[model samples]
Target: MTVTDVIDRVSFMDFEPATASFRDDVLAGLSHPIRRIPCKYLYDAAGAALFERICELPEYYPTRTELAMLQRLGPEIAALAGPEAQVVEFGTGDGRKSRLLLNALDRPASYVSIDISRDQLIREAAALALDMPQIEVMAVCGDYTQQTLSLPTVGRRRVGFFPGSTIGNLTPVAATAFLARCANMLPGGAMLVGVDIPKDIAVLEAAYNDSAGVTAAFSLNLLARINRELGGTFDLSGFRHYAYFNEDQSKIEIFLISQREQRAAVAGRFFHFRAGERIHIEDSYKLAPATFQNMARAAGFEPTQVWVDPDGLFSLHWLLAPL
Candidate 1:
């Protein structure tokens, strides 16, 4: 083995899209009075880049707030993970929080990065492996919610790392089912998850609808993705971004409102939208520690500990799967 022989330990088990999931979804969603799409689809290369910008916006508190909490608590969380635990992350690969947690772990057996996007997953995992040659890197490019993760046989204890309040994106029933699914993944293991704490409606609203219109652009790109991949003919100018907090549901709602009554064709099917109709893009709920604890318990896990910042706008929890 030469001095340049690095990254040999990195392995990528990728899932390539073979069918038209986007077109089928677009067809299903647009055939409704108020169209809806899953938030998971909003991570094309352009969408992902826009979201990175969304995190840096002044009004976006969750990203920075969670990062700060991780800064102070990563080591303690790692200690609870015990030695040589496998760290598994869901969705896209995050660099900032990844560094903090990876640096804190004590000789973690391997790091498994999973996501729906093959490019982003492979790219980020390869980069991390090249940068930190000591740790084994296994990149699985597939929907973390659906795929049963295949990790190295050497590791016994697994620690699931899911941050950025991604869990907030699911509905109550879906969240419970997803958590139960996660609990199933790591039998007798541990998970570190981030949850956005409930706060004033005003603060939550501003985070999704920023002054700089970055969020707007991010919202519109979803339409562009449909146009590109599904042969859609959506007029970008005819739609505008809308975001608000739903007090009754305690969640953030993001939509693309039709600026004018327009008809658009996607995958050979045309749909008409009224002048003021809205296309639902996302629904994200803020979870109180107690709320999350209840949800975790339903999912077959015991909530072991919770960490919060001074403001209590966000929380990081450590959960243990049934042994």
Candidate 2:
């Protein structure tokens, strides 16, 4: 059936009010000297849907590459994770990877899906619970980056699942801190993280700047979200999506550039934008395998094993927490 049909099977915990953080972050980010928005706010329902479409685009290799790798290596990953483990996935978008992972794990104790998008989180979690009735499902709605999440206590080990190379959205320092927090949260357990590898500049840029314009739509949806949620007066036509690989930073930087001078109001506050002025939207950093391992080690995790696809487009890192 549908997600609503199986909603009762999923346990949901909402830690953040839907709009407060969005409003506050929008105001604060727009007020900055260098106009920017926290990339986390980009996952409203519409944006999430656009992202799913982007995953299917031929230019977007990360999702397909990672999924293939997971399908091929699921058993090996399950072996490292061990049996009866509680799988806690961060930013559990659509729970596609989680389903594959939980299927591979031997009698996984439970599945905890955390995400900022509440509606999508509940929908996916409910569906997952229905599909895998043997495992318990708990859906947490919150910005995992900002909140100290209270997870369920289970006798078995807690395995953290962070797929989709979303870690690249955070700065290196922030990623390290985030991993350290995961280490604390899943003590004596382990983490399975998907990381995107640095590739040709043209390939990197094409992934975000797709020919079908889906990625552009995904970027612009942020403004639409603000207009709908925060009463923002943003003229969607006044801006254009721009993304490029910054070789120095080793990341793909995405921005919305104002086509002409204009002003947009959000939450009763107005902000001015000059022609060609850019509002930084996202950064997807590509770290080398050795570099990421070092960062994980610095974050109090023992880098156990890393599996890379033959194409060298993506990698899955398995890290162990100290006993």
Candidate 3:
């Protein structure tokens, strides 16, 4: 079976670097007094599919709110991106936001989708290239956070598209560093980023603890992954997905709780979890516009435009960098 056939002029590259970081990170995190797992591992195939479902959940406001804002600001986003621009997207899952910008962008010369999941990148990039034949499609499957990205020759003006508030996954310092890296990558470029604004605690809590439990499944999938890949013998049923809004931190925290005291082995080592103990999995930090703007400025990006949704639940920021 052809994994990424060039059906309609789209090019695909699968790059899995030689790195034992996954296992190393897993072992180190589990060895910690408070267990933790990097949020990136939560996107293994099953986890990615679960996330797609989560985006559709009624309680999840970021996806829909960001989509609405993108739809309304298509013209403005396109104009800000300017003409003959190239779009580089981070974590190109489903390519929903990319479609919005690509469709609106005028005479954009190329589209580069960078994602860690080869399956996702190939699928979405091929479809996008097929749908928009005028633009060059370069689908890259690799880690974007590690500062190891090297882009191919493409359009002159690069416009970065980072949607879905994925930046929320990083700490404030990391986010600033990430934005700085992006700005440095595209010297004379601009970017449109989705930032989830802090809102009512009740609303935030409901969003993570959806009635349908998709988010819960998404969180627990991390354990399932450990079991499948790391020789882990976790009793999936022994744990429950837990999420809450940390009022002080202004972030949504996800954890996996051991219902009762239990022991699980990973990579030939057994780890103990106390009854009702929690393993921190992820944090989704909601940022105020000013805070996000400050990050962009420090990253060498000047915020040119900010679009807010009707209810003030989300924002789309347009940041331009120097030549």
Candidate 4:
């Protein structure tokens, strides 16, 4: 259970004052005409595990597609990344997929993984440390959106690995700011980013609303998490998972629809929802290649190369600092 760098690693502290406030905000939002909770709050350990299951589901294309792309081109990416590099991954879940690139790196000096969930990060870090004794494993527990991320002070070049297409979780503005933050933390070098390409609305919707019900369970798990964390009472049976593609917006919106009119009190606030009224739980924006390229430019990155899948259902954009 011990990792190679367990002594060098420090435990993470939760400084998300906004976590509670955001919870209250979501409840308030649910009380309105259209209800929704931010999907980011869905990763409270159990939620993270549920998400891992969802990824394994056949209907979930993003995970498999990205993993396949990585497996196919990993050696090339690793070669381009070179050795003596410091690899920093944003949202380092499971850490299995990252090893694909890390292993290909021929043993980079160290690997720094940042995750909001402390336990998961520590567990993965320990396991990875044991597996790859040559690479230093440093785990930071904090929201990557805004955190003072710590990394090795010395390395040839700091290369950022942002796989999983998780950047789609952010709105365009948030994505811009996020990329800028990552760039600031990384010394001038390159950023290997995975971006999910825009596709047909039907295909996009189907991916989120899988037939196996795993996605639904994932969407509704938020309420279960609320009950566990905030002492809120939510009848899981009372809500239905709803996901649909907003063609104009080019995003898949997942909602928890009230199966029947219900009332709940959270943090001394009374919230009401009519039958069929939906709480917008999550939004995964599908990015057009041009649009995401422009986003990277705004964040001070130039798109040097893009790896698209055979069917072109997704894309991996390799953005680098200006020459």
lDDT of each: 0.83, 0.90, 0.87, 0.78
Q: TM per model? A: 0.95, 0.97, 0.96, 0.92
What is the per-residue lDDT of model 3 for residues 2-100, given as tens digits with 9 covering 90 to 100? Answer: 563664467776664333677788889989998898898888788889989999999999999888888889888877888889898998898898898
**Can you write out model 1's per-residue Cα lDDT over 223-301, one digit (the tens) per residue?**
9998988888999999999998888889999999999989999988889898989999998898899999999999999
- Backbone clash numbers for all candidates listed: 0, 0, 0, 4
- Most lDDT-accurate candidate: 2
Using TM-score as the yardstick, the better of models 2 and 4 is 2
Summing lDDT over every window of 10 consecutive residues in candidate 1, give the lowest-scoring window.
1-10
In model 1, residue pairs whose N, Cα or C atoms come closer than 3 Å (at least 3 residues apart or on different chains), thus clashing, are none
Residue 138 lDDT in model 2? 87
Across residues 1-323, which tens digit of lDDT does each residue of candidate 4 receive? 45334645533344543557666766666666656666668777887887889889877788888888888988788777776788888888888778888877856888888887666778888778778877776777777887866555546778888877888888889999999877677756678988888887777878888888888888788888777776677899999898888778878777888899888766656677789877877778888778888999899887777888998988888777653
Model 1 residue runs over 4 Å out of place are: 1-9
Deviation of model 4 at 57, angstroms: 1.1
Query: Which parts of model 4 are misplaced by more than 4 Å?
Result: 2-34
Order the numbered candidates by lDDT, best leading.
2, 3, 1, 4
